[model samples]
Target: MPRFAANLSMMYTEHDFLDRFAAAAKDGFQAVEYLFPYDHPAAEIRKRLDDNGLTQALFNAPPGDWGAGERGIAALPGRETEFRTEFAKALEYAAVLGNDRVHVMAGIVPADADHARCRSIYLENLAYASASAASHGITVLIEPINTRDMPGYFLNRQDEGQTICRQVGAANLKVQFDCYHCQIVEGDIAKKLERDFAGIGHIQIAGVPERHEPDIGELNYPYLFDVIDRLGYTGWIGCEYRPRGGTSEGLGWIKPWLKR
Candidate 1:
């Protein structure tokens, strides 16, 4: 079975962020990931990880001013300096947490911005972030988020993400394949997994339409899990979903997988 990581940012929300580490462990998760960890001190987060015997699987670099509707700055024109600064800060947290992967949000595109300009900026920022992350032995992940959830998200397709990864040409740069987004943006989840497994660095999953637990999704996670195992993907699969009910109560889908 593929190793699973509870997304502390989405899962275990009943508890405080600092307490989610232990909550995940108590609920039988061996590892955890989150959207961002900058809100807490590195030492505090590390202490929770140590206390709970959990591994930090992944987390995203800061997306600029999240409250102000800026999902990220990587692809934004003239924000290269801010993007790089956030990446360096993420690295500091990773060093303390011993996490090896960081997702680089590509930011929302401006209505008046040229697509070519946005793509160029995105690629340039990826190259810079990937090269810098490689020095710390960390991999940079670019995910294809569905535009439905994030209306203006710049990176919203697997092919686009693959192209960006290729242009960056950094060994540490890879795709963060979110099954939920892929299913919405493009179907053929199993085929995509098999075809692009080589380029993928991390994976995330949630139910279709509602973005809830995988058990009720349009995709059959059991067969897909078997497919992933057969395809030899040894990386962590992040459970990035909102619980339909209480987080712990909704973990029935994961119990069987964890038993494997």
Candidate 2:
């Protein structure tokens, strides 16, 4: 039915992390995603979800050196140990929330880290993560972030992500397609989704240019949602946009879509 989701992290300074979910609940959202929940125990996060009947849609793997601008280390050499450890921690939280997928965040590529080397490291880690998550029935997702937002970031396109998913060769390893990023890095989001739908395990969104409410922006979400609905896409459509104010103030933009 093309269920919608709000990403908790996008609330940023506009709303308290938890208040976003609460407002989302009131705004008729029943699912949500988070970039990182490692700081919050799985038990408490799950309690929030249970208390509000909100399904925890997805969360990113532990981000390394985030303050220094490092997002992930999944593709770094000799860091398989760090990747796996953080991935395990992510799985622990996923289990607690019964989340179906966890995004295996790809880190920046060092000046010396070539595609062959980074691809090898990323796929190797994916193979390990896919197998581990399979036992828990949780899929591991790899999202392609735009280089504009992430300089030197690895896995910035659908083709690359899909190819690595093939290399990983595990049922649990799939693409975490973000429409916002793809629209920025590679346009024609619907066409790309059609081409790589099989590898896609999840979806996220934000308006282009201005990452605000869906209606106040360039992306025609109704059309996007319609296409996804017709294509039998069952994954959560995560709203990972920057709000103009507290969630409620700017959320009236999506009021039309809130109807259940």
Candidate 3:
């Protein structure tokens, strides 16, 4: 059976961000991941994790000005300096927090921008991050977010992500396979997982169309879990979903999964 990690950013919205660590542990999660952690001090977060006996599985690097609609700066034309600075900051946090994986968002592609130029910048930036993160024993991750939720997003396909990983030629870089976005962009969930299992570092799941709990999704998570085990994936499967009701109340699916 796969070890599961709660996505505190979306899973435990009922409590304050700092308190979610305890909430997740009380609810039976052994690990946790979130979108960003720049707001609070890393030491504080680390203490919470230690207090709860929870491991920090993953978290995203700083995406520029999230409130202003800038998802990430990595693929942006002239923001290479900012992108590297943000990644270094995240690496600092990860070192103190003992987090090993960090996702680097590829930013949105401008409608009128040159595609080749953007791809070039993205690859170089990833290579830089991969080298820097490797020195600290941290791995860099790239995810293919669906365009529906994030229109114009630079990376939007699994194959493209895999290709980028290969082209970057960094052993520390891998794909963050999000099932919700994968189903939206390409429907073959099991086959895709099987094909890319070697390059995949992390996995996230949610209901199709609604982005809710896995138990209420169009995807058959139970069968997919079987596939994950049969394929020999040993990483954490992140529960990156909004609960249909109270976060704890909708976790009936987890108990049965743990028993396996």
Candidate 4:
């Protein structure tokens, strides 16, 4: 059976960030993931997870001046020092949060920026991240965000992410396969999963067009769940989506899976 983790970042907006841990556990989620834990102390976040019996499945490294519209700095030149500093902080939190996966976002670049230069910087940053994280038994992840939602984002395809992982050549480095992004950029979801399963570190899902509950989207999640099972993917499937109504009210779609 495919295990699902509630994405506290997007789901359970009805409660405070810390309080969302219990909300997700109450909803039968055994694990939880969020965008960034820097706002709260790692000890506080760990306490919430321990209190709710929930595992911290995944989270992103600091994405450099989010308020300034910078999504990430891993791909940006002259930001290597900043990226390493922020990524080390992420690993420190992961040590306390007990999560094995840390996603390093590829920052947006200028339309006229040199693509080759960006790729070189990205690969170097990823190599550093993977090597540093491996010492602590942690895996670093790279995700391909859809251009429609995140224009100018450096990475935009599964193959591109996988190829980067190969170039980085670290056992602990892998791709974060997000179904929502894949459906938008490439329609052959199942085949892609099968083809790229070897390099996938984690998986995420949401409605294709609206980024809502998985069941609310065009993709048949139930069928895809079966496909994931057949593919032998033993990783958490992050419920990274917004609720159309109350978060819990829209959780009926996951009840059956939770029971299993």
Candidate 5:
């Protein structure tokens, strides 16, 4: 059976980190993942991880000011220095949190920015981070956000994500397999999983149309889970979705999968 983890960022705020941590543990999750850890003190986060006996399976690198029109700089040219500083900051937090993976958030690039240039910058940044984080036993993950939901994002396709991972040529670099985004952009979830399982470092799920629980949508999670089981994945599958009601209330649909 695969371990399950809740992504607290989508379900809880920075103020509710501890509360959610305890909740996830009580609810029977073996671990937890989140978007970013910059808001809380690294030591405090580490302490909580120990307190609840929850593993920090995944966390995201710095995504620049979303309010300032910058989502990330991993694929931007002028933001190379910005990416380094932000990544280093994320690395510090990841080390303290004992997180195994640092997901690279693919931000939106301006319409005028050259795609080749963006790819170049991203590769450079990946090379730099891969070398630095490898010493600490951390893998850098690349997530492809669906363009329909995240317009102008640099990487949106599984193929493109794989391409970038290869271009970086770092053993530490891998793709975050987000079921929600991939279902929206490309529907062959099982085939893609089979084809790229080796390069996929993490997985997340949310129902299509509502971004709610799997039982409430078009995706047949029972079959999906079976496929995952057959693939023999040992990593955690993050419940990264919005609840129709209270976070705990929305978890009823996934109670069965949690058993596995």
Candidate 6:
């Protein structure tokens, strides 16, 4: 069976951020993930995780100016300095939180921007991040987000993400395979999972059309879970989705998996 990590950023909205750790543990989640941990001190977050007996599965490095709508700066030219500083902060949090995976978001591409230049910058930044994170036993991740939700986002296809991962040529650099985004951009989900299994470092799932619970959508999560199991994947699958109703109330879909 696949291990599921409750996404604190999208799930458990009813509880305070710190309290969500206990809430997830109570509901039988052994691990948890979130977007960023900059708001609270690393010690505080670590305390919550240790207290709740939960493992920190994954989290994103600081995207540039999240409040101002800047997603990430790794792909943007001339922002290497900021990216390095922010990534260092992320690594610090990862050290305290005990998570090996750190996702690096590729920023939005301007309508008239030079595609080649952006790719060059992205490759260079990823190489830098991979090398820095390697010393701490952390893996850097790049996710291919769908254009529908994140218009103009630089990375969008599974092949593109994997190809970039190869080009970067860093063993610690891998792609974050998000099923919701993949379903939106490309339909051949199972085949893609099988073909790109080697380069994938982490996975996330949500409903199609609406980013809700895995069982609430058109895709048959059970089948996909079987496929994942058949492929011998042992990583945590992040429940990165919004709840249509209460977070815990809508967790019926995952209860069966949690038992294992």
Off by over 4 Å in 5: 12-15
TM-score of 2: 0.94
Note the Cα lDDT for every prediction shown. 0.92, 0.83, 0.94, 0.95, 0.85, 0.95
Tens digits of per-residue lDDT, candidate 2, 144-165, equal: 9998888899889999899889
Q: How would you encode candidate 6's per-residue C-alpha lDDT over 113-182 as one tens digit per residue? A: 9989999999999999999999999999999999999999999999999999999999999999999999
Q: Which stretches of candidate 4 lie over 4 Å from their true place?
A: none
lDDT of 3 by residue, 41-130 (tens): 999999999999999999999999999999998899899999989999999999988989999999988899998999999999999999
- Model 4: per-residue lDDT, tens digit, 117-229? 99999999999999999999999999999999999999999999999999999999999999999999988999999999999999999997999989886899999999999
TM-score of every model? 0.98, 0.94, 0.99, 0.99, 0.95, 0.99
Off by over 4 Å in 6: none
User: Which prediction has more favorable TM-score, 3 or 5?
Assistant: 3
Whole-structure CA lDDT of model 2 = 0.83
The true-structure Cα RMSD of candidate 6 reads: 0.7
For model 5, where is the 10-residue window of minimal lDDT? 10-19
Clashing pairs in 5: none
* Candidate 6, run of 10 with poorest lDDT: 251-260
Give the Å shift of residue 36 in candidate 3: 0.6
Show model 3 residue runs off by greater than 4 Å: none
Better of 1 and 2 by TM-score: 1
What tens digits encode model 5's per-residue C-alpha lDDT throughout 1-260?
A: 65678889877443367688888787777799987788889998888889999899998898989678777878877887888898889889987888889987767988898888888888888899898889989999999888788899998888888888888889999999999999999889999999999899898988997787667788988788889989998888988887777777677876776665
Task: Quote the lDDT for 234 in model 3.
Answer: 89
